[model samples]
Target: MQFRHSLTRCSAAAAVVLLGLAPGLPAAAASSSTIGVAAGANLEGISVYDTADVLNDEKIKDALSSIDFNEPTKVAVFSRQGEYSDDINSETLAFAREEHPEWISQDAEDYGDYWADGYFIITLSVEGHGDGQIGTYFGEDRKVSTSQMESIHEAGYEDFNLSRWTDGVIAVGAKGAKIMNRPWYKNPALWITTGVAGGAAGATGLVVLGVRASRRKEFEANLSTGREHLSNVTMDLDTTELSARTLPTGSRHAADLERRFADFMAKYRTLFARQQELEAATKKTRSSGSGVALSKDFIDTAQQLDATDDAIIAAAALYTRSATWQEAWRAQTAPILEDLAELPELLGGPDKKLGPAGSALRSFADTAQQEVQAVGTDLAAQVIDVDTALDRLSELRKQLTERLDAYAAARIGAYAKSEAEEKQMRAKLRKQRYASTGTRSGGSILDVTSPAEFFWRVSAFNIGYQSAVKAVNSSRQAASSSSGVSTGYSGGGSFSGAGGSSRF
Candidate 1:
């Protein structure tokens, strides 16, 4: 979705006059100490223009100052309030061009959408309270996995929803730093370079000897945490396996659980062996007093073991949810039935007070209800497969959302009185939707008063049957991916298809 376009570039003074925005960006003063360590000068290149005046500039600067990066990196946070091009990436890039041309490089050989070799942009646009889009464009040097990007967004989106402007901005920046900045232990490149420059044997002898003890202590501390997490997961596996053994003989759920448990247990045994090897190696290294750098390959295997816990949790929840599914199916379906029954009332009854559209809506609802109920009957009889049932239920949910949104669009405004009210209503509806299934979905289909407000809702009505579909699909990822995060993306951009409307 990347586009190539050149914008009208302007100098800072003319751009300010034309755009009518004061720079307002504070220079990050160099500090010898910050947050109990040396404050990074890396964020000193950060340009935060709170042009919307919603954020506390000083607070944001303070948060940014506390963070550091592995390289010279520049970040910009642009908070704007108004009608935008709906594509935040495009708008943000355009902002960089017209407002801060210095951020984008004029050298054709060096770039595409990214302004420079080490710059990134985060743009937030709000049209009304509780509504806005947050978009990020990353430079190659600052690129992250989609999972990491989501983690960053998760850290801030709720705050934005709550109108904690300062907190949200700070959270986004802080999370970005945490992800982009590699801790000394996690970064193998530094170790490899050091080992090569100095002798590979006991590279600790090359630097200050004090560093060896500290590094060893840090590694052990991290290893202890990993062991704790691994132990808890191991216990969970034990409990689940014991439960599986106790299931009724020939139970289908038991078979499924047993299969997954066998696969997981095999991997778990390997991890335990590797863990023992690591402990043995550490003891040897300590006894030798050589301060040798051990192979970090174990770190990867350790991470893989930690990720296995996600799959175990998913399998357990699936087993538990499947056992009592009938009750949940009935509860979730009841709301849809109620909504269908209330459709005629909403459209001014059987006399067609709302006319042809109302009649068409009723016809659509009737057809959907009949189809969904037939699928439900099959579900009750255990004749319908899970995938097929999910498909039908998901289709029904979509139609209901489209139809209801249409009807609401043609009818009243003010579904919410304020941003706070909109959030409250959406949260309450979401709660009702997932109460039986134990899953929460994002989005709103409430035909809210402002377009911006709908952004916060995730564009759906999670109040009825969709929750059932979500309840299963939600855990599917956890069950499938060991890391519980998506894998792979194009080198050119963020998401899998290299998404967003930023220009090259």
Candidate 2:
């Protein structure tokens, strides 16, 4: 049975080889990665000298030998070969076939496969012409340049012809090290932004910071929506600016915002009402003189929580006619319009009369549009910031109320005359808390204050609440970092031999 299984495996392997070799079969192109496969791995370099020139140079040999490959993250020399080729003629190919027969075969493309499997496969060609193609055939998507080879060769040759053999080889080897060096895309923290269309996947790279792991599609969608929303808001503000001359008494936009503000007010009022009711009931229960006195610190903190609610409501009220996000966009539009005002003639009103200055005006208008778009983007960010702030407040209210309930129950338990009485009073307090607070939302609030003990006593409940707040803050940071358009060469990643190259 073992023999039969082996035969079947061999047959499957042979079929894969045949398929890979078929003429019409497409070669596997270089894979792209925003995060490179070998991002954090050390680079191992190899040099293949086909001519007697290198072998005859003691300095070149010493420089090559001096490199140490034992470090976790540096380049080091691997080997020097007399002749090299992409086909079976190269010593590297023979070694691959003999040692890693399973990994190397007729259908294998790019020597980087060997590199990936932990063997250094960088080949330095003594002669540039045939060696240039080595990367195309053996190295996974590594592009070898003949021009680069010639440049490095000429530099070495200038010294070499004058019997500066050591200088020449060292120069060539140094250049070769640069050319063969593997680029590590280790920037884990990447900023991604959405395109004008706002569809989730239509995002580009915008900013690079410290390394951060990313969930590509999900991140793209979120950033795109955020940008798209901002753009819409900007456009709305711009329209209002353009039509400022008109009286337009009742604004649909203002009304919509007003309704939202009202909803927010209602929610805040409900939270405040529950807080007062709990405070009064707990006070009444304590006054029974059952040896239960509520902590003054807790009461003060609860009052501050109520104050925070008031501040948030006040901010909403200030945006009665127009929100800051909208007003900011409107302010930006005035400048853009002023810049375009001179171009109205060039813009050719109705008659389509683009005069001699038409082209210049058109150019100016385009620039102005871009500036306006940028303004809109800023406004959109503001919108997100404001909304996130409100969400955090809601989270804080939920946690604060829950803590209040727990404190009340604990105090009532202490005051109970008997075990049955303690249980009855605690149950009644819990029911009253629920009736006043309603259902809870399972989300953490952002903790804006540091040294929380100044605001609230250090209780077990307070400690847990602080931990949850930290988690929320971390999540917010990650989300904010993910917002932007990613730009240039971060395609997910590709390999090319720009480090070094040569031709005979």
Q: Which candidate ranks first by TM-score, i.e. highest?
A: 1
- Tens-digit per-residue lDDT, 394-452, candidate 2: 33334334434444444444444456555555444434433323211111111222123
Clashing pairs in 1: 131-452, 443-457, 443-458, 443-459, 444-457, 444-460, 445-460
Evaluate residue 34 in candidate 2 and report its C-alpha lDDT on the 0 to 100 scale.
27
After superposition, the stretches of candidate 1 with alpha carbons farther than 4 Å from their true spots are 1-37, 83-85, 181-184, 187-504
C-alpha local distance difference test of each model: 0.53, 0.36
RMSD of each: 22.4, 27.3
Tell me, by lDDT, which candidate is best: 1
Minimum summed lDDT over a 10-residue window in model 2 is located at 438-447
Q: Residue by residue across 1-504, what tens digits does model 1's lDDT show?
A: 122222323332333343333356322211223222445656646677877878787777777877765556787789887564355555566676678876666567654444555766676677667666665656666777666666666677788888887787778777777676454333345436534755755555656466666667755654565566557557666654655454443544334445545666777777677567557665446333342333233444444444444333433333355674555455435535656776655555333554554666779778978987898788777687544554566566556656655544332223433454444444554565333222121111111111222211112333322342344344454544422222232242522221132110
- After aligning candidate 2 to the native by TM-score, how far in Å is the CA of 497 from where it should be? 22
TM-score of each: 0.34, 0.21
